[model samples]
Target: MAKSMSLLWGAGSPPCRRVMIVLEEKKLQGCKHKLLSFEKGEHKSQEVLDINPRGQFRRGVPSFKHGDLVVNESYAACFYLESQFKSQGNKLVPDSPAEQALMYQRMFEGLTLYEKLKAVIGYTWFVPEEERHDSALKRNKEALATELRLWEVLLVTFFPTVATLFRFGLSAERYPQLGGYNALLKDRPSIKASWPPHWLENLKGQDNLKDI
Candidate 1:
């Protein structure tokens, strides 16, 4: 019999979203998805702890389970999926050594950018207004702005090669190239299908994360 995989995840998490994108890209036929709730503290529940005793939930949402094998962390899970399920749909990790290296580099940068973005989101939105640190929020926003500008610069010089790095939300005025790239990624079937439902509801009127 073919192996079955279980995926545990929280909604609206970028790491979870990343893994979902990979899962959709690979079109895993026997995977089961379980959505966790932050409001209900589902991540800290005994069920999750039973599957992953020492897993770092902060690092990623979607944890993968295939029989006795378990993988946590979005990057590790995505890479594992790409490596193990190659005979199916989209190839995420690339073939050539040079191309693979480039893809890895972009993925690494994108992950770093997401970390900063998460910090910004945490301070500005997730955290209670009374509990949020103004200084930390300011610093995180500044750092994110710097990284975004760097990506914009890269987009100008290496549009074709680095375009995939700008696959998420972006500002049109500050990052015209990345904005176009974001549109392309948003249009992707996998990305569209796996997009955070809550984000779509909340961000409907917003153009960018500049003010947030």
Candidate 2:
């Protein structure tokens, strides 16, 4: 653990949760840590401002105000933690040459996942009820549907062993695979420890209906 490292984060945001998850997964031999509260307005404080030049971020990833490295994006934080704690989970990240290529591909998909989810959250919950845009909602939902199909097709085409289990294209399809994947993701102790439990409401679980 670095002597001067600190993680500024919120309790329920997925982005912050991801950071915490990565750290816990790495579990470097000795890491002293602190969790700053976003609800307390710590993120907007001068301390954070000094470290994050942009002074702004998406999701719950906090800006680092005074560190050798500052990160405001959750995915970047994941990449950073993986690099810093390579020893603990020497093989946590994909290592084989083919896996390496797949890793980048997954990261790219993960980035897209983050962006699309953010849009869903912003449209469904963040925007004030009165200011909410139907067009935006429609667009996001449509996009989500499209993305769902893409994921389903890939699952069926490339991972057929797990294909029967996931219903990706529609809520009415059999999605045991996707559900299994989500269950696996949630099973990770690191993700379980850091993931925002309170925000589960935001998930609405509507996507699960695809298998209906």
Candidate 3:
């Protein structure tokens, strides 16, 4: 079953890592994958564009293909995997409706958190130097801080799958609960196995949020 799956992903991307974690948890290790380079704009290459047209707008990668089914969104692809292969390895989705609803909410909220995070750290990289402003960067950091606080409060309710925040300079000292949660998650077999390959090469990550 895994043989029919193909993934186009960037190792440094959290979204791509999420799908990779799910795949590992589900024992779908045989799925073919193309590791793209974001630095080289490989995510926007013709190979990715063939599967996800949005690649033209920098909205690609982490694309999953299962037989004829193609899912471009990271979270949706994860849901599809959990729903279709519930009997395989680990059970990700809950049996009760209430728990499932909470999971869905957290999943979507995670997307929002990722966007806010990118807004802060990616501002200088994504925006043109001529158009960049200190005020805009300050606003982005404030938004990300607010989002992080929300997640910190709910940290105990779910596993810490969004460790990207820490990599980008979210101080574990400020959010002790989240820091502990992330530490526990780091030891999980799936998470450890799916950790970004590039990150393994560089133990120290970027500190874009040192002041946040």
Candidate 4:
């Protein structure tokens, strides 16, 4: 019998989306997906706790359960999956030491920017306008823009293979290069298959990076 792999995830989560992209890329079979509801505190339930006791934000969503081995932390899970399943799908980590080092650098940089992106989203979308600190929001937006400019330079250097781990896009007028980057990879099978479901329904005018 094939081994079972259970993915506990929440929709619209970047970390969760990252794991889903890996699973899709590897084309894993006999895997089960369970969506958790934060509103209902499903993640805190005993069943989930058994699989992942940490359950903290960083180690929370995007957890992978295979037999008795449970892996949390999106990067840890992703690296383990990619290394273990190398024979199955496209090799996510490169073989050359220098290229691999560059890949890790990109991932770490993306994670740093992800925190800033989260701040932008929290301040813009989730927080009420009256409760927000406009000054802080402005600072975060500018910081995120700066990081994106760096990404544009890297994309030019790497030409399409850089930052394949994260899906970030922006409006053309605001970020022409990143916008073009989004367009370039919009149709990739992994991205297309793992595209956020809600975004698909309201695709016409939705800005993928409105918060930034």
**RMSD of each candidate?**
4.5, 6.0, 1.8, 4.2
Which parts of model 3 are misplaced by more than 4 Å? 156-161
lDDT of 2: 0.54
TM-score attained by model 1:
0.79
Error of 1 at 72 (Å): 1.5
| Candidate no. 4 TM-score | 0.79
The collision pairs in model 4 are none
Say which prediction, candidate 1 or candidate 2, comes out ahead on lDDT: 1
* Model 4 C-alpha lDDT per residue in residues 61-172, reported as the tens digit of each score: 7778877678878778888888888888777888899998988887877787667777765565667778888787788778877877787677632212223213344556
Quality of model 1 by C-alpha lDDT? 0.67
Kindly list the per-residue Cα lDDT of model 2 for residues 76-190, writing each as its tens digit: 8777778766877544577689988877786577556545545654565567788888788777766755665566555422121122113222332344455455555555566
TM-score leader: 3
Q: Report how far off residue 13 is in candidate 4 (Å).
A: 1.0
Worst ten in a row by lDDT for model 4:
157-166
Between candidates 3 and 4, the lDDT winner: 3
Estimate the TM-score for candidate 3.
0.93
lDDT of 3 by residue, 100-207 (tens): 899888878877887887798779779999999999999999998887788788884234345777787778899788788888788899888777887889988889
TM-score, one value per model: 0.79, 0.70, 0.93, 0.79
lDDT of 3: 0.83
- lDDT leaderboard ranking: 3, 4, 1, 2
